[model samples]
Target: MDLIVATSAPSLVLAAGERASIRFLEFFASAIRNPHTRRAYARAAGDFLAWCASAGVASITAVQPLHVAAWIELQTQTLSAPTVKLRLAAIRHLFDWLVTGQIVPHNPAASVRGPSHTAKKGKTPVLDASEARQLLDSIDVSTPIGLRDRALIALMVFSFARVGAALAMRVDDVYVQQRRLWVRLREKGGKAHAMPCHHTLEAYLHDYLDQTGLRDEPKGPLFRTITRGTGQLSKTPLPQANAYAMVRRRAVAAGIDTPIGNHTFRATGITTYLKNGGTLENAAVMANHASTRTTQFYDRRCDDISLDEVERILL
Candidate 1:
């Protein structure tokens, strides 16, 4: 394919040749299907190439293992280990792609090692069950925006859905299945998962849909932006950044002290469910995780600070 991806190609990649530029672009465009991963990998590749240029590395082809190692070592000074690992992975994967395509003789990033990182539990701050309830109850359902926010939050909490999946829903994605509300989520890697709504989620979704008259527009976005002056739901879907800001605002208004984000409810729900006799295998299925190990990260059932244990200190 005679693709012209060089116009937007970085100087380091372009200096290598047309073949290298096309291969570099293809690494992100064709090899990586997930938009989030693609964007991250693109940023990593760009930043590394720019750094290489600044360091007087002539071209992408001239990149060496020492260059990648030094770059990653520099990254460790400011970035977290997991972040440095991901950046290294991006560089490693891109070079591997280039090597396979015959654009380069070797994968220079292959021999480099990233910073070590290991975690028994996730760092995402989870809300207590009462805090989740308080956040939900604090929303003013008198307005469409309020109802939308409540429902969106409830969906993530009760259904164990990622924020990306929750926001990607169409009104039609919520439908009656055997007299109960079911939500269809196209999760990561285009996995289609359908989940029965928790009774509370059902109520919230019903309120948001019926009160906002969103049920009438089955094909439109489920959660949407509010009109500039009208305070009514607009055609545009709510972005992830807006969702984060909204969650923070709602948490503060509800007097929740724990800092939380879009993923907090997901972890909170998983932890709550596990605490309430939910199994790891079942939780994994509900969360659309490929493995129980991944679901285990969200299981914060043991996260409670044991005041009893603390009081045992004689001092």
Candidate 2:
């Protein structure tokens, strides 16, 4: 096979030689399938190698634990702990691959430790039940775009789906199972998760499909992009960035004060469910989480309780 080096990581090719460069490209092109993760890892690898070159590191094999540690320290000064940690992971994994391929004698980043980060609560901004309702009700469903946006947002909240999983859906993924509306999501790690839709979500989906005449196009994407100059849905799947922008615009239009994103609805739905006396285990199952601990991070009932306690400070 020919050596195919990505232009973004020119330093890797120049420092590591052709054999090592091919292994490096293979790690991203073949090993990492997820586009987002591949892009992040590529950036991390490229940045780290470029820094090494500027620091007078002679070659890729000459990099040591000290070099890795110093790079991480510099990263901590500019990036968040989680981001630094992720970059470290990317570096470590790349070296591990190189070592196994006999490009390097040992993994230099293997012994390096990333910055410590622990969080009981996630930073995703969540909305109250009333705010969520207001946002949904504010959309004018006179056009295909309106119906698409409303259905997409409702799918995330009602199904507790990640934005990626929600956008990955095909029209056939939303279908009748046992005479009730069910959604099938291809979640992280290629996990196939199916859930019966909430009544409100079912109604929104029905209206979206019926009005848009998308029910006949079962193989097409469930959420699609809108064509410019035409108020019609395109065959392309809705990009996550576009969905986020739409959510921000909708929130501002709804008079919501909280700065929310695509993830806000998922967190909001989980919090609302827990507030109404839902069990953690059940919530985990609904959210398709392998552990209740992961689901606990989305439970923002404490936010409401904290607000109530602050009211006790009477003058």
Alpha-carbon RMSD to native, per candidate: 1.8, 1.4
* Per-residue accuracy of model 1 over 44-109 as CA lDDT, tens digit each: 999999999999999989999999999999999999999999999999999999999998899999
Candidate 2 lDDT by residue in tens digits, 1-315: 443454534564557787887887888988898889999998998899889888988888889899999999999999999999999999999988888899999999999999999999899999989999999999999999999989989998999999999999999999998999999999888899999999999999999999999889999999999999999999999999999999999999999989999999889989999999999999999999999999999999898889999999999
Q: Model 2, poorest ten-residue lDDT window?
A: 1-10
C-alpha TM-scores of all predictions? 0.96, 0.97
Q: Which candidate tops TM-score?
A: 2
Show where candidate 2 strays beyond 4 Å. 1-8
Model 1 residue 309 CA deviation in Å: 2.0
lDDT of each: 0.93, 0.91
